[model samples]
Target chain A: MVKINGKEHEAAGKTIAQLVLDGGYKPERVAVELNLDIVPKAKYNDTVVKDGDSVEIVGFVGGG
Target chain B: MIPSKEEMFAALAERHGTDMQKKLSEASVAVCGLGGLGSNISIALARAGVGRLHIIDFDKVDISNLNRQQYFPDQLGIPKTEALEQTLSRIAPYCHITADTVKLTPDNIPSMLKDEKFICEAFDKADQKAMLVNTVLETYPDKYIVAGSGMAGTFSANLIHTRRVAGRFYLCGDEVNGVAEGEGLFASRVLVCAAHQAHMIIRLISGETEC
Candidate 1:
């Protein structure tokens, strides 16, 4: 199981883009950080998760 | 009589110990984006007696900004840096501030923050915030950057969190919310997030870096 936002999940063979959708975040609204480096929006479909790989998903808020 | 610069700064930092006071007085911070977060963060830092503040922003004050930004009605139509400098000087006379009315990008960030060990990223857009954070991490690997995200709308105030996202990067906000089309921004929530950045800068400069 791979970790998404610090929680374990079974996401074998799925691309980061798919994981972002599965996690209920809109593709355009969210930013994905695989391991430590940020995954550019263009590469979301190309990047995949491995077991124990940490992921962090964050979004922008309105106002300041 | 108004005290001298040194005397005023000392008075402002009087309650905090010598170490903290000295650290604050000697520290220089670059506060980017003088919007809601930048406005509050810079003012907070000034009140805390940070020595030199490099306030950068290129936008002019608009009426729409009154909802959550720290500008008054009389200051509308003026550049953010100018208005912020005027306000900061009135309230926090001891703070030595350099207001640069220039649009900051990944390229200018290094020069803007060259002498700063602490940076407060207060941009309004996610892309801008991400750009600044990424550039800073790549360039100023040793400097600490305090950024806020997911601070929009009027929701669970407790959800706003300040956590260390990387070795030298700290993030503050709910971490899940965004600017939904109809979602409204609460002034208090925005300021709550701003306070996190301000407090983090203070704590970091004071040698209390753990939390």
Candidate 2:
């Protein structure tokens, strides 16, 4: 299991792209951080989340 | 007649307490993107007697922005930095406001934000917000960044609050409501999130970082 936003999730080996999709977040509207490091949008499809990884996905909106 | 600087300072000190007012008067902050969030946040900080502000934005005041942003009908077509500076000067005559009308990027952010220790991320687009947050996190390790997000729709104001994301980063808003979700951005909801950001900044300036 992996930790997403401090919660335990059954997503040990999923890519960041898959995690965002599973979480129902628009791929373009969210920013991901893995273990305190930012994951670029272009690299989300290739970067995978390990069992102990902690992810923070911050979804953004257009309005200020 | 406008109050003298000493009178204004005394009034603020009376309202905020002498110690907190001193900290606020000595503090400096940078606000990027003078939109609904940034404009309102800047106004709140100014009214609270923040000593200096570095305001940055490339856009101008458009008519549509009147729906939620803090701009007057007569100020349309002017650069946001200039308009906000004019407004702030009237609100807090002793407050120092430095404005730059340039589009911020990962390249220019470091140089532009070098002076202020506290940064407020108030950009409108999702990608731009991410870019600013990511750049600040990777570049300025010591400075604090307060960002706004998910403040859209007619959701309850109670949800629009602050969360400490990292050691020096704070996120404020509902965290779920978004204009991209087919909901609208109303003045009340947007100002609620902006108030949270302004309050968090005030707390940070007062050394109350734990939240």
Candidate 3:
């Protein structure tokens, strides 16, 4: 199982791309940092999620 | 002898009162760009009691800036930071100030932001804003940089909105909406965005909010 926003979820062999889609966010607008390393947008599809992996997704907002 | 927190607060209160003296004595901030947004933002921070301020601006004051910039007409042709330093010193006599009359590029941003708890991005160009943001994030991931955009022309005060874009990176003013090229800005909207930027910086510094 993986935790997202502090909620436990069944991993079930999901890829990073599917997890982002399941989280209800546009992948392009958000950056994914997994285990202290940034995962480029181009690799979202190839990257797979594993148990105990910490993923942080940040989105852009208007700022000066 | 070391003073207790209460004693220190009381001493500050005697000079600037509890509200302002307390806040100004606790903050260290940097303002990049001394143009329309930077000019007003620096003044507000000084008046609000930010303890230390670092101003960076390469441009010089011109006759045109008198309409919006707080600098006097006599300051024409002087570096923007120099002009702003004079004004800020008078407003916050006890505050420490460092003025840099140079552009904020990737090469020098690291040193410019050294020891600064908060940074205000008040540049006029989008590329400059992006450069500063990228460099700061790459170098100091935890440092907060509050940026402004789309404050180009005369717009209603309500149009300005301050939104958090990322951890320690906040965007203020209209985002997708902006004034067209060649348009002139009014004092009302410029000051509105400037106030929001200053307020956000204060909130971040005081730990009232996380950027």
Q: State the DockQ, from 0 to 1, for candidate 1.
A: 0.38
- Model 2 chain B poorest ten-residue lDDT run: B174-183
Which is the leading candidate under DockQ? 2
lDDT of 1 by residue, A2-61 (tens): 888788889867898899888776665555678876676668899988888888876554
Grade the docking of candidate 2. Answer: medium
lDDT over C-alpha atoms for residue B211 of model 3? 40
Interface RMSD of 2: 2.1
Pick by TM-score: 2 or 3, better one: 2
Q: Write the per-residue lDDT of candidate 1 for residues B89-153, one digit (tens) a residue.
A: 98778778899999888678878778889999898877777777767777765898888888877
- Order by lDDT, highest first: 2, 1, 3
Model 1, position A1, has a per-residue lDDT of 85
Model 2 clash pairs are none
Off by over 4 Å in 2: A13-28, A36-49
Write down the lDDT of every candidate, Cα atoms only: 0.82, 0.89, 0.74
Interface RMSD of each: 3.0, 2.1, 5.7
Q: What would the per-residue lDDT of candidate 2 be over residues B1-110, giving only the tens digit for each residue? A: 99999999999999999999999999999999999999999999999999999999999999989999999999999998989999999999899999999999989998
